[model samples]
Target: MSVTDPEPTVPTRDQVRQAPKVLLHDHLDGGLRPATIIELADEVHHELPAGDAESLGRWFAEAADSGSLVRYLETFDHTVAVMQTGPALTRVARECVEDLVADGVVYAEVRYAPEQHVTQGLTLDEVVAAVQEGFEQATEAAGGRIVVRQLLTAMRHQARSMEIAELSVAWRDRGVAGFDIAGAEAGYPPTRHLDAFEYLQRESSHFTIHAGEAFGLPSIWQAIQWCGADRLGHGVRIVDDITVADDGTVTLGRLAAYVRDMRIPLEMCPASNVQTGAATSIAEHPIGLLTDLRFRVTVNTDNRLMSQTSMTAEMHSLAEAFGYTLTDLRWFTINAMKSAFLPFDERLAIIDEVIKPGYAALAG
Candidate 1:
């Protein structure tokens, strides 16, 4: 008797790379190419921890893997140091688009602090303009293979949230898609930027808050209930509010239930979460539970260079950890596309005509 061959397994790494992706939460400063960083540092006379690209890359990975949010954030200091001029910002932004396109990302929203890049005589508007120029150039260079937008981020500990929020709104028609607050979340909470959040709400602008990663449920509650966040950056800690019993039963607390029921997307970054001590391992990541529970979960590369990852790497790791098929990967992709800050018709077009068809081809 002949036996039917085992059903086709999950797509391979190369196939995953070829699949269309939508990146909702990636950091512009956190994803520069090491070689480019080295060159930029020399131009700006910024001393780097490691002179060579290979060694510098290793240094970032090692420092970020220290399981400390403070330590993980320290790596960005080097990257941001060289990004102080219009030319430097343009170069980084252009290369960011090229890299994402190479990784099969059809659309992405990259965030950075305009305040960080203004030290070298460049105004906040200049910095934003430089980055947008680069994105436009790179998109044209690639023959419009990708669409990249900016999410203006304000450091939570700083006092520029209101200014940055205004900048984001001002540039909304000029390639700026949304606003965000990032930085240490321990003492500095999302509620501290209530004015900015309220302003965005008044202007009817989109904004996400970085919460529930380094902090806990209280942070998540404040972001949603108090601050009215459009999305939760690294909302991995919502898992803490969920309980799994020995009798094979699972339950979610009020906060977690609200997050899931409201369909608020969780920008979960598996590798970066592990590096920041938010998760123990890929197999044990809250994404597994959240996906099983039908939460609005989306995968991302929060800091690609720091985690030594790409969209393909993130998807592949999740697939290996949870035996996810192409369909599963597509589910994550569609979720991200749906949650993007783009217009409804634009998001729907990409999800239907681009993402779904790409995944269908891979599934076959």
Candidate 2:
């Protein structure tokens, strides 16, 4: 079964769903259940483009399918609109974990900007508490089958990174895992929030930056070098720094080589990238080249509702596009678990106890 073994079978959708997966860069607001959104909207008298759950779900996917990143983000207004109150936030977070478990996710770090949820007079701390309550409720209901954590994200366009960073650190021991900065990356560079990053670093805290998605190498360079980001959220544009020669020679630019050598984690969301014009399609995604180059690349569903995806769906798509096998899927899962913001011992426990055994059973 060594060198002469036949090629491994490409995993089917159901098989992939049965395999344990780890997610590291999903958005909380972007993954609300359409039905929940409908009910919550009705409670607040908020208007929706579509009335029924099915139609509203379709609307979110179609609206996000626009190639412009800004346009893709616009679809969140409705989902965020209804998620104003504490109960609404708790419900969404609870259902989010339940959905992940059903999708075979064993571990995940879901992110959200608390600042975006304060429209109805809830303080940022209250928003965090509300979401944590939901996560805790769902985790208990699942009997600890799936481990989930909150990643507080500050809107890059806003000047509240310091506050969000402080909040993340304050709640780190409770349920929050880390901090992040997200929003349109064109005009708002990660460097704009250097004070927050510096403060986090001084406090020995962790954070990831939204970089290299809508922007190019410059954004990624700043996120890593200037801001000291622990991870690069949707660092798809790093491909621009890689050169594939006509004679099959591959050259990595200084920044790209440094990223690879340093073992920086890139949270690549292929479908979301395609939707936001970061990549042409899954077939042409830089994930293939980056994987071949041994970069610390991890797959994620940046927006589940918008991309109409789950961990299983992402793995299935990669299998069809790249002929990934169980072994390949296992590698991606382990990478995400290892790069998780949890303590090393806890991360290792999940990988060895849950991820390794689950994938081994699938492979067997």
Candidate 3:
């Protein structure tokens, strides 16, 4: 699967859909189904930009493709508006799991800021509880095939990071698996939440920070050195510090070398990168270079609804753009499963029993 190889034949949608996948970076608010959004909005008496499901879906895709992050993020306003109640939150979470199961995602960690969903008088703890209940019900309904975990996120520009971090630790044994900081990456750096990061560190809690997406190496450097991030959320800008020589060799700066040597997982979202202007296009994404250099790269759909992407679509695009094989896809899947925030024993069990065997079957 070298970069110079001719583009591989694109896999059919069905073939890609059936291949077992692992997703690490999907957002709960960003992945609501359009039909569900319509129903929920109507129930809450919230007006939407589009009247029907199909038009709403098209509107999201078109708005996200407008080459502006502000425009892209604005679409979430409608989704968050209807998700303020308990029933709506639970229904969305359960349906999200069902959708992932149908798309062949065996393991997924969906993230969201509990603060964003409390506008309708729901407490933060209540919001987390509702989502957890929904996930448990969905897993049971799916016959225990798909495993879902929640990563509680704190809005970076807000001042409630420490509160959210504590809330995440409180729900660790329930359904919450990790903590995260998300929002504008350019103006608000990870260091802004140092108190929250320190509290998480003291509690021995795990967290991944949003860095290197809209910002450059400085943000990534601070996230690693200052905030102590375990993994990078859409850390696409780490490539800025790497220099490729004329002889086709690569050199890494201090920060890049530290990240690679430490094996910090990079949650790279290809289609979302293009939508958010993180990358020019999928073909020019740094994922190919990072994978070739063994950077512990993993693929993800940051926002399935807004980007109009899925785990299968992301994998297919990577295969077509970088000549990836079934073997390559398997490696990426294993990388994500290994980097997940599950307990060590459970994580190893999935890799040994489910993910490895699933990929073996696909290879045959």
Better of 1 and 3 by lDDT: 1
Q: Write the per-residue lDDT of candidate 1 for residues 172-260, one digit (tens) a residue.
A: 99999999999888899889999999999999999999999878888999999999998999999998999999996999999999999
- The backbone clash count of each candidate, in order, is 0, 0, 0
RMSD of 3: 2.1
lDDT scores in order: 0.92, 0.93, 0.90
Q: Can you rank all candidates by lDDT, best first? A: 2, 1, 3
**Which residue runs of candidate 1 sit more than 4 Å off their true CA positions?**
1-8, 68-70
Per-candidate TM-scores read 0.97, 0.98, 0.97
Candidate 2, residues 1-364, lDDT tens digits: the string is 1123244888889989999999999999999999999999999999999999999999889889866656676788998999899999999999999999999999999999999999999999999999999999999999989999999999999999999999999999999999999998989999999999999999999999999997999999999999999999989899899999999899999999999999999999999988888889999999999988989989999999999999999999998898888888888899899899999999999998998999878777
All models, RMSD in angstroms: 2.9, 1.6, 2.1
User: On a 0 to 100 scale, what is the lDDT of residue 119 in model 2?
Assistant: 95
